[model samples]
Target: MTVTEQTFWVVIPAAGVGSRMQADCPKQYLELQGKTVLEQTLAHFTHHPRIHGIVVAIAEDDDVWPTLKVNTDKPLYTVNGGAERCHSVLNALNFLKDKTRDSDWVLVHDAARPCLRREDLDKLMITMAQHPQGGILAVPVRDTLKRVDVACIIEDTVDRERLCHALTPQMFHIGMLREALEKAIDEGVLVTDEASAMEHAGYSPLVVEGHGDNIKITRPEDLALADFYLASISDEAASDYDGLMADDG
Candidate 1:
């Protein structure tokens, strides 16, 4: 389908305090390459021609959002978020109930994951077109994983095969996702992400392969990593442009 013909919306959950980052502001508000992490994250969807609109769930007392300048032509809506990430995502979904159709795609992305590549996002949109239950952008686990105990001792070495690190922009039908999240919450199932909620409802979400660099900025160290990834992406784009110029010459 053409870019303008594609119909999908994005929901970003930016409510968390991000205590793990140990930052003065939420991790999403932390500076990355001059702009806040949330700003960079929003740019991905906002720039994509396929995206119809975006809903951001922020804290009720958030004063920083008003200060930060984000430029986008797409319709942006903000809602009061709940106590946790799942609640915030649910709130955004509820905001879309009357605005979107039941079959329209909704992508739930983390506000701190600013390094989501355009190629990966494109791949996700294409892959989910045929997926009834929808899918997520994830990378297969590469390292030897360990099942650890509370004492910080390794209990056993877990098999790496069939294990994938779940990433964001988890795409699903707005109606299906809202229903999944509502049912999961009603059953007291604490879903960490949209795919988990779908899984709890007995629906298998697809795993579309993505790069490992689609990292979520959780700790202070992750900011550095995200900066590195962003720089690398810029360098790659420049290289491609130079190659095209040389080919024309």
Candidate 2:
């Protein structure tokens, strides 16, 4: 099917407690730019014209989601998350099985990643809209790498030429992804990301380049960085708006 004929959906896995953050609640629930991290992350898709719907996988005892003020006219649903991120994604797929066709696209994103740029999202959609395997937003590895052993000693300098940091919003066909995840999980394979599951199933997914600012909130320092990025993004938008008004006048 063509791009316009395809329906795009999003799945957010937000059940993790984020023990690394050492916070009172999950990192997704932590306040960022006067809103929860998950809320900020959802805004990118909820306000987008191409997104058909969204499914958020929350913890079984997650009471915070109901209390949040999420403004969206699009179809939004929630399901109880599983032990791991892959399990949660698979659960979301199962929830959408009856509601979507096999060709419909599913973009699985991390709830903690709140700084996904609009251009990156569009690039992923435009590039992979009709692609048979699907694609993801990623950035090239710029920093030098070191292979450390158990004693924290550097064994060797790893090659960074072909390395890329995998970011969220990994897009794929709904039915195909579900089958892949199920197959990987059945054999106790560690399906870290959607693309890995697809790879295990013998499909080469496209990798779309994205900005490095799209970061997952993993530590306290990251919260500060995200806030700064959000502020910068707002300032840029305002400047662009002023420029547009001046041209219109």
Candidate 3:
């Protein structure tokens, strides 16, 4: 793969079984539209000029491998993820460390979030360049906020306007993230996200505003919405390409 000088590497942790999706296949490998959810994700990075290569982190005995339809010519490397999300990411980082220098950029994206928008991703890249630390894509919370007690009742209405929902393609300088992961492992810190880990280390990650349609495919109903988004995207791309071809002809 022609990894551009400024190219960023991606680590997709596909180790989770995704029991919430209630599908026989692991959620990442499940077909959406004409492509697998994981494939749709790869399409984003593989086609991007700034993305150099990809390292997919999967389980050791993963059953989803045989069914995937990979199109990128870059070699796919596999590593067994730990029981937790941070562990899986650290394992992927260790694998990537052998291939890249410490200063390179690494992006950790969720495998289930196939409905990710291209524009949002490009925004993240631009944000990272201007950012002092690093950045991730996220959408501001538009709805009213609430802090519920253990009884499932609302304790108070928090300011929702200040809250933002974290999404993926979370980017960081390679060495910085690796150091954070190492500290997390030694200190037994089970961080919820990469941003949290960075925060733990006293670094603030810039949040690039994302769209509502950049949905994470979590529940079953999300799959239906994913279908609609995919069809619309395909139609738009086809029309755009046809116009370009017409002008060329």
Q: Report lDDT per candidate.
A: 0.87, 0.89, 0.77
Pairwise TM-score winner, candidates 2 and 3: 2
Q: Which TM-score value belongs to model 3?
A: 0.88
Clashing pairs in model 1? none
For every candidate in turn, the CA RMSD to the true structure comes to: 4.2, 4.1, 4.5
Candidates ranked by TM-score: 2, 1, 3
Candidate 2, residues 19-81: lDDT per residue as tens digits?
999999999999998899999999888867679999999999999999998888999999999
| lDDT for each residue of candidate 3 in 1-249, tens digit (9 for 90 to 100) | 112235578888888888899988778878887788888777776655567788787887987676776766665677888787888888888888878887788889998887677666666765585455787888888888889999999999988866899989899988889888778778988897899888888898898888777777888888889888776664322133233222223
Highest lDDT against the true fold, candidate: 2
Once fitted onto the true fold, the runs of candidate 1 whose alpha carbons sit more than 4 angstroms away are 1-6, 235-249
Clashes of each: 0, 0, 0
Q: For model 1, how many clashes?
A: 0
